[model samples]
Target: MQVHIRYFSVYGSTQTYAEHLAGLLNTSAHPLEVPLPDDATPVIALSPVHGPVVQAATYARKIQGRPVAVAAVGMTLLDVAREKDSLRKLVPEHVARFYLPGKLEFSTMSTAHRATLASISTMLRAKPVKSANDKAMIAAMGTDTDRMDFAELQPIVQWVQSLR
Candidate 1:
């Protein structure tokens, strides 16, 4: 079976996971910006979950007719059920889904993200009340934090192996 891996990462955690997976699968992982190959092969896509949304879902329409599997990486925790629900809009129901935790380096964020994080931090710090999510985000306001683990990739590996 032919496998094509496409991924996008901001801080490189997802890219790391993608590379590791590609290494094991013995396939090359390309950036999502590159065009999907012309043949109908299984596609393994890795993208960071920004707001629990797959950032690379925008590529779904371009990859129709190919079997697909997705891995969503994020600093925030999420369950597979929610991910499945969100992923249905992006891929067919036959598409497999996986979630992996990723790190967020405050210094490595883009300007727009940094500005947004700063605003949220300021609001949460100034306000007497904060929601659980807000509190979590506030508590995580620091540089060089990591949650990614290589062992977390077993599900993805199993999915790919099943395909093979």
Candidate 2:
């Protein structure tokens, strides 16, 4: 089966994953801004997760009832339970979900995004006790931190192949 790959990326990590997956599947990846090619093509949407938000949720909702899968890329690590809970809140339960690690490139971020991170960093610093994740976030504030791996696309690739 032919599949359509779309990505909504902020700092390019999600796009990188989408393109790599597309290459493996022998398809091309398009930005989410492009309209879907057809009704029957299964869609794999790779979107960045910023804190509580999954950037492509609105697009997913817009294309409801289609064969759609969402790959959420983020820096924060989560247990399986938390991942499920977060996905429930961010997208429709019917949508298949996957999580992938993402990179944070502070240098490439817009001024507004950087300022917002600075604010978040300040709030995190104010906390009396910090989790390991929080400490890592604090340390990565003004630098580029990458957690992406092309091997992580295997599950998505397997799922897409199953559709055939």
Q: Measured by C-alpha RMSD in angstroms, how accurate is candidate 1?
A: 3.0
lDDT of 2 by residue, 33-95 (tens): 988865777888889887677867667766755677888888776444244557666677777
- Residue 132 error, candidate 2, Å: 1.9
> Which consecutive 10 residues in model 1 have the weakest lDDT in total?
76-85
Best by TM-score: 2
Worst 10 residues of 2 by lDDT: 77-86
Among all candidates shown, the one with the greatest lDDT: 2
Candidate 1 TM-score, true structure as reference? 0.80
Q: After superposing candidate 2, which stretches have Cα over 4 Å from the reference?
A: 78-85
lDDT of 1: 0.77
